[model samples]
Target: MKKLESLPVEELLDQLEVLVDQRDDGKDFLLHSIISIETALLRVIKSDPESDYALSIVKIESDLKEHLVKYGTYLKTEYRKDEISAKSTLKQALRYDQTIPLAHYRLGFIAYKQQAYKSALFHFQHAVEYQRLKPQHKMSLSNQQSYHALLYLSNSALYLAAEAQQQSQKISIHNDVEQTKIDQLTLSPLYKLIDANSSYLAQHAFQITDSEGQRGASWEEYEELIDDATKDALILDMTGREIWVRYGGSAVKLTILNAELLRKLMLNSSETVPLAKTDLSDLFSVQSGDIKIERYVKSISRLREKLRNLKLPLDVIGMVAKPLNGQDTSYYYRSTEILFMLIEYAEGGQ
Candidate 1:
């Protein structure tokens, strides 16, 4: 097999013509030859040649995209080079043709890995929007890939909203204008659109909201990452912004605050140990006697109902009781049937 570049441009073209002739007869051979021709053309273009020698720039750009995306995906899967090669090739593809949706998607995926959610959002939006505008014949992004892009877009917006909510909480801004901005940040229309596509994402969108009254679930059906054993045992995984609970052979993802409340109960699951309403109020950042404790109490009651419905041993989580002296009540969980684990991120890292 002669090196593709060793052949002259005319010779490569002649070979490509022969490959086209054999396309139906020798499909494998034709495919191999097409790849060879594409590689040779890329080499020629990279050589800074005087002319493309009758090669159409549009065709070359289109072919390069397929090659780059395939090779880039391979490199990404291999994980040996850490995606640097794939990223560089995709960047080259973008330089060759700015309108290539795959190139933009690859770049956006890289940004997502780097946790540059804002940049990822921008690139993914462009890739999806531009690809949508192009004719069907020119479409390079598959339906599944487009769906994934939409998911990533929604997740990015959710992350941004979560971050903004966290910031607003830190400052405790009371002004109506600042409050409105915080509300907008927490309730993004983009997330609602994404959530509407699936019930799982809709629950996710609910968790990410700043709504204090949102009902937290132990786990959502979409969270397949948590194993069956965990679900059967009614275990709770607190990682990321959501708390995943497993109960009644069903799983639900709960909000961070709700998970925190459960975590507190789990830590003090011994009968000798109990969490006072005042302590719970402090954990929730509310005054000791504030009416907000009622909400926290309601959340605990919901959690208990979920656990009881699942028939999990609730001995660990005793109950909420009123003190005989008319003082504020305390909650306790003493059963060992339920287990809790703290996860730092989606990968289950510390």
Candidate 2:
């Protein structure tokens, strides 16, 4: 096949039309090919936003979205029979449009079924967030999806907290450390989860029920149960490579090195001490030298930029300057009282 970028606009439109016809006729068509064509057309529009083809491409994209959603819903209903295909189809639907709550809910359900709680939590959170933004009249099935997503979000958090507690207990036993301290660290994730759940409950009146047809606790009652556990802090799951912000439960994606640096900063933040640039360089195994300090400072700068781009508070990572032996200035990094938790999964959990 010719490269998508090399194809003329007319050829791209022709291919899209053919794929739409095949999809509508119940004939086989590669979803990837359709996606490629759409991406190419989008790139063209991005380069020339005022082009006449933009309107046509927009209409074609609408048709593509409709078809993808219908096909994805069909596959989701059969997910129990062929999970791989269902997941791929739903994921492709998301690739085309990430705002689809139904697709996110289905993916979250699949992750929950496979006991991948972290993954489930991520998708369920998105499902709930997007579903709330959808119009009331358009939410025939999505309202139910939002409800189930909230339930599963809490369930996923519970499972993850239990797992973290187990891991902490094992570590305490092996290392003969203080159980209270370990428990405090391990249970911090629960605090974030509870805060998120409580915030949602406070905003939306969801009539959650038990599997046995029993009425579940109201938001007020649920708040009482977790009153002692609620705290305002970021939750960083190092093993899961995910970070949950306070209140909104938005997940922040960080690069691996940045995440490790954040973990180190959070660990030291308990003592309210700033980590010097030299210490950060040592943590990353950078050689002790002027160049090492420069590289580490740049890394910190990049991390702050990432946080800013994600609309997080820059004070999450604070920078301090001090005199080096009253001659030159040195920089140090400190984090707010953010909580870091490790989430270990079995191989191939996803």
Candidate 3:
């Protein structure tokens, strides 16, 4: 992936031109090519910081701060918040520099705070898009913000399911070679987030009407859509030495400890199981202490990084922190909405 960003300037531009030309060719091809072009462009800009393209990106970033200040002023000055002006300024920032991920995220947050879920979803999606296309070698402020964008994007989708008007503009995630690529490249991560968050939403009182006009309580409609999008499942093999996550035509392997954590949650599938530091210490045979907790957390983080590299969902190991008595805290691993299977059982049943 890093190499993709390191191509020569002429080559990167040629590739980008080809991709831009195919922008309207089809969504699948467009997304695939766009990602490639973004990777190249990010590399090109890094290699030549003084380039016109790089300066344009920087200028857009500077303008984004100006717009944000204006947005803040609008919130403070108007008795009734001038959301329209704030949004207009942000959109204008995009017109000058569409690659500005921060602008998109700020716009998304504004819409989200205002309870405009559909608008929030659109901006967050673009934030995700820009973040995904950026070079991943180094961490930028925008990169850190993308994590929050993912969270907001998923929540926005859930809320949008409740909007009657949103039903009319259903996400066109149908089947075909191109559509499949589009779904894989663009929609899979969103579905993963929704799947991870579903259990949390399930605990609350809510109802959603899907694009199909089918109504269900507590994110059922969104969950069903996520299920449909997920054609594969994470499965435990008979040997118990590894975990296998299937996605489209590929699979990712996991370490035994990681596999067990997923298996424990998947078997329960609905409960948020408490996992104390002591529990982790016992499970991994590590000495109980802050060190053990740190190691545990690092392991989980690495697992997420691996899944992300595989283009699989980060929901593979979903856990939320809950404070225990005193200063101690326990992590609760939730089964949430992930679909899982035992490879041995699947084989035996077949």
Candidate 4:
């Protein structure tokens, strides 16, 4: 076959059609066919020549997003992080709008990875604000994406605040007891927003008038990365943040794939041992060994084991994954005080 670069998009699409139509069994050729089609798409967008190729840019950007969504499970399974090919992906977004909320979100997240909190805050905040303006105009989208965007913005703000609080002089501790009290309250969403934005004031010693950030993170830059959990949660959310990772467990992930089917079954199951697979899938809405679920569970297991060695409460892990029936959804997961502890552990590398 001709290299993707040597052929036109038309040729590639036709080839993709043939592969899709010819496949007999999904397990046998589905992955191969999809991978080939994707590779072709990537090659075409790998670079751009002189001329305004607006069509090319649009196609490539869309392709990148589709790939992310379609293969999120697979990518997540193999890598701890999404590990997107950011250089090319960001270039497309940057070519369009520097202030685009989605663009800002990506940039800010990228910045977060680089430990550039200053830059990350700038990007994340703008992403939230710009996205707030998005409207259906005439018709509503099937999934009003702006809602998720808003949540992400709120979450980012909290994280930014948490980062600042961990630093000195951001907020006067007054005493150890007060600090612990503040930490406890910070677990709530309202406090998280306050703390996250308050970091801006605290960051530069700009006369700390409030407890945390007053304004919040910026959406124009994504350039901050730090490894501090307590603030990461307290600053970003009221209850705390639950990180979903790719823990690489096939059986566990399968349960997640059958989440709905299993949930129905769990409705009738009894007090579980270790946790009935159906019962767990129903509770977490994360069927089997989803990477995110795996990360969460393993993180919890690691926490419990450590507590045992150190002689801390063992039920702490249960506290984190209490599995509230109401909270079972794709948007968020339920957690207890121990979830915060796990986040802290992940941060401290313990």
Candidate 5:
């Protein structure tokens, strides 16, 4: 690659423009473009500092920052199977733009996976703080990342506390005085942080009901009502046969039929539209008869009870006897807060 700085000013601007307009064909293309653009931009900025050019240097810099962040995110997410490479690339991107919360979150996740809890805490804290500082528009990527960061932050704190406690216990066997100091210096502070973040998460994560006592809010109200807690409050992992509720820090096991019913409702759910008896029958491959409705009601009741026992909001699954639609009374997931994984099984699993 010829030194972009050696190229005439006009050619440099043209090349930058072309690179900016280039569609993302693949990771290689993105990586190549990011490197080429960054090399040229940095060189020019250093040498010229101030230049009157056809393409504004400010705009080019902004575009380069975006590309750098994008490539960093790709490396962290898509290429995450190679943990070392992902972390390195993300760190390089942070050197260019430190405000990318997604990069920080990914790095934190990698650190957490490696059991480097302290490093994980640093990155996760940064991700949460930066995400909170940004405006959270409804259903935006920022909002999503904000929720993820907070959850990870809380988990990181929990793990750190556990680690500290273990260390304290080891020290207690040697010197009781040192153990007391360690508990005060480390474990207490970590516990406070974990409690504070967890409280914030539970209060804001999901909006259980609308003003009129409706189960879920519309898109317009979703942004205002929901917060970061919604991300992990409830996770249905079909492949693992796990229903994870945030408050308890454990999975709630359900019968296969009940799990299937919950999964069906979740898959077909709409904020404003509820799935009728006919829909449920089609989904469950059962006859649309009284027995089917009775069975569904019992299954939903059991699911709701399990969720209730876990102290999760009851409105996670909403049922209406008479929806606005002319169909039979129906059921739907009240909020879009629940995370459903391995959805492919919804089509094939029993």
Candidate 6:
């Protein structure tokens, strides 16, 4: 999926225009296009609205509202009254629940684009909540549950990214010289999810990936990184990966801890020291390939001893300590955060 957040303005707007134009172009999928266009427009709204762009967005937003009114009427009249088939009704309900999250996500992305961190937060928060409690669409139990978690993570990432940008002071919204500001709130739900589900998400995302990796090379956006032992390395719990999306038969899996970590991450703001492993097994459970937990312990111990010999703070340096007893951590590390830590623990072996 295209990360809509970083899209160039022209490309994003052009994509939106295409969808919007097609909605009224008398195509068979006009209604679907209408929804798609409307959703994409929310994304565009977060951009700095130049005078050149303002009127167009205003018109698009207006048109989208009109379409919603009309669509709702259709649902009440034709679709209601037991006229529509069960399947059709189900599809509509699912669509309804999906559309809001889609639009809100777009809006949040836009806010980030325009550097309106708080507004972006508002929209993204709505998207996440819509994930937990919603229109209750989708008939299949699994699809419904998956969709709920997927959007929850997706929205959480947007918020997380926004907060990260703020605290890191990397984002500068230069509306004018003196009006710029920072937005801070890190390690939200997605980070927790990554810490907990790093293994499963990596496994699933990699299972569906159709790309390859090379030494010192970046992944092809969709490729999974395999460790020397050859298991799908969820080394990096991508905040975005928690969308709970499955590709083919592969999907990110999480243990009971994954959910709990995510819940706490979303609610808490303090930095957490990672939980140390109760034993190597806990840490090793998440590892794959030929790497044995015993081997990992021996290796880690060697590394620690070496660091101690160097008179370095083994506790503060070298490999990051993980929480095995369940406590603070700079909690809420995205998938990538966990991945980085594992890489260090593995002594940077591919």
Best by TM-score: 5
List runs of model 4 lying over 4 Å from the truth.
18-64, 68-100, 136-350
For each candidate in the order shown, give its overall lDDT on alpha carbons: 0.55, 0.54, 0.48, 0.37, 0.54, 0.37
Ten contiguous residues with the weakest lDDT in model 5: 341-350
Model 6: residues with Cα > 4 Å off, grouped in runs: 1-99, 138-350
Taking all chains together, the TM-score of candidate 4 against the true structure is: 0.33
**C-alpha TM-scores of all predictions:** 0.40, 0.44, 0.28, 0.33, 0.46, 0.22
| lDDT for each residue of candidate 3 in 139-188, tens digit (9 for 90 to 100) | 11233245556777888986665443233325533343233343334444
3 or 5: which has the higher lDDT?
5
A best-first ranking of the candidates according to their TM-score comes to 5, 2, 1, 4, 3, 6
lDDT of 6 by residue, 214-301 (tens): 1222233334433233333233222231222122223343322232233223222123433223322221211121234344444344
Top lDDT model: 1
Q: lDDT per residue, candidate 5, 47-109, as tens digits?
A: 775655424554545445444443443333332334465567667667766766766777787
lDDT of 5: 0.54
**Regions of model 5 farther than 4 Å from truth:** 16-30, 73-82, 136-141, 175-350
> What CA root-mean-square deviation does each model show from the true structure?
24.7, 21.8, 22.6, 17.4, 17.1, 24.3
Residue 279, candidate 6: C-alpha displacement in angstroms: 52
* lDDT tens digits by residue: candidate 4, 1-350: 56666776567657755553343111222433454565555566455454243345554444444333322223322234333534344434444445445555555555655767667667656756665565322111112233333444555556666666555334555564335445544436656565654454234221111123122222222012112322322111111112221111101122212222222222222223123233343222111222244433443344334334423222322231344553322112122232221111111100
For candidate 2, the TM-score is 0.44
Provide the lDDT at 343 for model 2: 24
